[model samples]
Target: MSENRRAEVDAALADVDFEKFNYQVVFETTKGTIKMDLYPDVAPGHCKNIIGLTKIGFYDGIIFHRVIPDFVVQVGCPQGSGTGGPGYTIDAEFNNLPHETGILSMARTNDPNSAGSQFFICLGRVPHLDNQYTVFGKTSDAESEAVVLSIGDVETNHSDRPLEDVKITGSEVIVTEK
Candidate 1:
């Protein structure tokens, strides 16, 4: 890591207050349940947007349209294609969070502000995505990590779409007691 990048990561880690700004995202998928711990202090806008969307059942029935072995599994587009959103766009909350295994980040086009409801989970370490995507959360436990791996390991086609559809049966924001 470059000095500047390491500094930014250190700062982000220091800024995160687990006692207050922490949140839990529970994604009940057709395969299994995947849960993550969200860090609002690092990417507040993106975190808030996802939590807001989850409250209204926005992700229910949404399919993981893109899945790549050893890369990422993506979802959150209402259209089930990669081009859908919540009829609005949120500003990019780029941070120093690394795209390591189990990390969840916003999926955007080349344009930073284009990130809407689409997001992805990293199956392995992807340093190239560091500071480029808004990483808001990560798998919080062994069970969630296992589920993420299972989803990422599924078979996919040439376009990285899974042969069988993996749907998000439900999504919820879990408030943990501090």
Candidate 2:
């Protein structure tokens, strides 16, 4: 992400409330249920958008298309890859959330506002992304972080896209105490 672009996202979402907020995104994939822990206290705007999209079922059949080894597993589009989204944008809610393993966050293009309904689950701990991306949740298991990385990064001899099938069967919010 560019430094200028990062600044823009932060400026736009400066007013999002986070004092008493939380969210959970449960992705019911054909393989199994992948539940996401969303920290609105950290990324308020990002978490609000995620919950809104989930309630409307905007992520059905999406696949974990992009998976780089020791990086992250990107998903949350109707088509299942980073290539797909609601065709809109959300201002970057650049917060203090680190892109550590299992940290769920939004994905965007060079355009800081191009993050609509696409998100990713950090496969391994990538400390480099701290405050650069929005972190709304985390995984309950470190093992599952590897699972997302494996699923998204797996391909025939390292293709850019996944060669196998990954589907989100259902989606909903699962609330929990802070």
Candidate 3:
């Protein structure tokens, strides 16, 4: 990471009010359940958009189309081809959060504000993505991290698609008590 990028991340983290923000979600996938803590302060629109999608079962039946072992496990594309979304786009909410292990981030094209329903879970620290993508949430604990790793470890083909379908069975939004 560049010095400038680190500085920007530091500024963003300094303003976090951990006690007041408690948006969270639990995703039940074929591999296991993973819980993530959403950051509305850093990415309000993206957080709300994910919550809205969850409430309407938008992620159900979605497969982990792009799973790279020790890197990331991406899903949330209704088309299951890494080219679909919720028929809408949200502005990028890049924050101080680095793309570390268990981080939940929005996936987009070259356009910064092109993210929609597609997202990915970081399996390890990835510094190259800092300030380039919107990180709206992350695994809240060791248990959730383990689940994400398990999903990332699935056997993948040349294109990084899981050999066996790893689908999101269900998802729900929960207000965490700060």
Between the candidate structures 2 and 3, which one is better when assessed by TM-score?
A: 3
Cα-based TM-score, every candidate: 0.87, 0.77, 0.86
Clash pairs of candidate 3? Answer: none
Q: For residues 40-65, what per-residue lDDT tens digits would candidate 3 score against the true structure?
A: 87888788777777766778888999
* Global fold similarity of model 1 (TM-score): 0.87
What's the CA RMSD of model 3 in angstroms? Answer: 8.9
Ranking by TM-score: 1, 3, 2
Query: By the lDDT metric, which is better: model 1 or model 2?
Result: 1
Q: Which 10-residue window of candidate 1 scores lowest in summed lDDT? A: 1-10
State the lDDT at 39 in candidate 3.
80
List candidate 2 segments past 4 Å from native: 1-22, 142-146, 149-153, 156-159, 176-178
Q: Give lDDT: candidate 2, residue 59.
A: 70
Question: How does each model score on lDDT?
Answer: 0.82, 0.67, 0.82
The pairs that clash in candidate 2 are 28-169, 37-137, 38-136, 39-136, 62-80, 63-80
lDDT of 3 at 46: 81
Candidate 1 overall lDDT versus native: 0.82
